[model samples]
Target: MTTLYLLGSAAPPVLEIASVIEGAQKRGYDVCLGLTPSAARWLEPQLTDLEQLTGHPVRSEYKAPTGADVWPRADVALFAPATFNSLNSWALGLTSSFVVGFAAEAIGKGIPLVTMPCVNAAYAQHRALDRSIAELRGMGVSVLYGPDGFEPNQPGERRPEGYPWHLALDAVARRTA
Candidate 1:
C-alpha cells in the first residue's frame, strides 16, 4: 500500500485538493489526510468522506491516535493549498498542528515531500516566502505546484481543473509504478 499524506491549509484551493484526493483513490491509491485547523473548517465533510474512502482515519491533531507502534509510512506527501502561514511555519520547523507535525516527521524520514502553495499574488511575491521556498527546495523538498498565479476568494478556481491533481498523482505514480 503506497501511503499518501495529503496536507492542506485554510486556503480556498482546498476544494481542488478534495477533488484530487477522491480522484486519487479512484485510481487505486491509499490516501491519508492531515488538515490544519483552518483547513479542517473548510473541508469537514470531505475529511470524513476521505476517511471512509481511504479506510484510514483522517488526522487533524497529533493525539488523535498514538502509541500504535507501527504507524503507516508514507510513500508520498503532498501539501496542497498550503497557506502562507503554514508554509512559513513548516519551513521554520514549527509543527503546531497534526498536519504540520506529520509533514515535519515525514520530511525528516526522507520521504518525498511536495507542496503546492496557494496564496494570493501579493503574499507570493514576499521576499520571505520566496526565501522559504528556496530553503525548502534546497532541503530537497519539491514545490510541486506553486508560485502559480491565483486570485484570492475564488473557492474552486483551479488553473486547469484536474491538471494539478494529475500532476501530483503522477509524481507518486512515477515512483511506485
Candidate 2:
C-alpha cells in the first residue's frame, strides 16, 4: 500500500483531521499522522481514536534512533492546515518540530509533497508567506493555496465549512503518478 505522511498543524482544520485521513484512505493511501506540537495538544482527546483509525501511533516528536522505525517509509508527504509559523520555518529549513523535520528531509530525499495552508487573509499577506510558497514550489513541493486553491478567510471568522481537504490528496496523487 502507498504510505502518506499526513502532517498537520494547529490551524482550525486540524480539528476535522479525521476527514483528511478518511479522504486519503479512500484514495488507497495508508496514512500516518504527524502533528505539530500545538496540534498534538489540541488533538489530545482524540489521540486514541486517531491511532485506531490509522492503525499506527500518532507521532508528535522524534523517536530515538536505537529502535527500528515504527511506520513504513512515506511514499508521499501531505501537509494540511500548514500554519504560517510552520510554513515559514519549513521554508527556512528549520526542523524544530517533527513535522518540519520530516518535511525537510522529504524535500532533500525527493519525496513528493503537497501542502495546504490555512492562513487568514491578514497572515497570508505577510511578505514571508509568498517567499515561502515560492521557495517550496521551486523545490517541487505542491502548495495548494491562492485563487485556484484555498482562499484566505477573514480574521476572527471561522474557517469555511467548505475547506477543500481533498485537494491535497489530489495533488499528491498527481505528483506520485
Predicted model with the maximum lDDT: 2
- TM-score per model over all chains: 0.82, 0.96
For residue 143, model 1's alpha carbon misses the true position, in angstroms, by: 0.5
Question: lDDT values of the candidates?
Answer: 0.72, 0.91
lDDT of 2 by residue, 58-162 (tens): 999998889678999999998888999999999999999999999989998989999999899999879999999999999999999987678899987875466
- Model 1: residues >4 Å from true position, as ranges? 64-66, 69-71, 145-163, 175-177
Candidate 1 lDDT by residue in tens digits, 1-177: 677888888876676665788887876777888789877887786777767776777777777455562237788888776788888888888989878787778777898887777766667667778777777888777776442422333344544553355665666666566
Candidate 1 similarity to native, TM-score: 0.82
**TM-score between model 2 and native:** 0.96
